[model samples]
Target: MTTHALVLKTFPAGSPRGSWPAEEFAARLREHGRGAEVVMDLVADSFLVVEAAPPPAPQDTSGHEASRLGAVA
Candidate 1:
């Protein structure tokens, strides 16, 4: 299954001095009830603070169709 993520922010790879801004940002997001995580992106050569996107709501058209058909003529 293909997974999707919502990228909240991006940061460059940290320096040797241990300045990890992406992780800090992710931590702040988590504290606010967001399931955020920091992951390294080789293709982009940077760190990404991302959250898993919720699944799309199902398209339940049966109720709508029924209601439309029940209209008084």
Candidate 2:
């Protein structure tokens, strides 16, 4: 499974309804180029915005750097 982290939170305008519309919020994320999935955090009682998965870590294949640094591990 992939882990997603919170990126943004937008509270209801005017009257605080204590929650945001899930669909609208998700759509908003898409519109804003976030394009992530939405999850409701019961503990915080707020919409938890998160991407489907975390980005992949960068890879280094060149052994030159490791050799130069004398990294044995």
Candidate 3:
């Protein structure tokens, strides 16, 4: 399987001020069809490493319900 890496800088998005939760970020990636692994530093306030699962084979999107949602880019 192929893998990809990403570097992320975290910041508060909603609610109270604090660093973004790693698990929540991971979950979002999973929802988008990518698996995520996060690495953090003790001193730094930002995240460093993220490894993601390979993208799945493309599926036909024509006539799918999601297509009607809106134009994707």
lDDT rank order: 1, 2, 3
User: Residues 1-73, candidate 1, lDDT per residue (tens digit)?
Assistant: 8788998998877545768888888998889999999988998889999999987855656555333456332
Give every collision pair in model 2: none
Pairwise lDDT winner, candidates 1 and 3: 1
Q: Per-residue error at 65 for model 3, in Å?
A: 48
Give residue 25's error in model 3 in angstroms. Answer: 1.5
Which segments of candidate 2 are over 4 A away from where they belong? 10-22, 56-73
The residue-by-residue lDDT of candidate 2 on 1-73, one tens digit each, is: 6564755654333334664466577787798888667666666655655665566765556653454565445
Q: C-alpha displacement of 22 in model 3, angstroms? A: 2.0
- Model 3 per-residue lDDT tens digits across residues 1-73: 5545555535333424564576677778778876566665556654543755357756656755445566454
State every prediction's TM-score relative to the real structure: 0.72, 0.43, 0.38
Range of the 10 consecutive residues with the lowest summed lDDT in candidate 1: 64-73
Q: On a 0 to 1 TM-score scale, where does candidate 2 land against the true structure?
A: 0.43
- Assess each prediction's global lDDT (C-alpha) against the native: 0.82, 0.61, 0.57
Q: By TM-score, highest first, what's the ranking?
A: 1, 2, 3
**Which regions of candidate 3 deviate over 4 angstroms?**
1-4, 9-20, 43-45, 52-73
TM-score attained by model 3 = 0.38
Model 1 residue 19 lDDT? 84
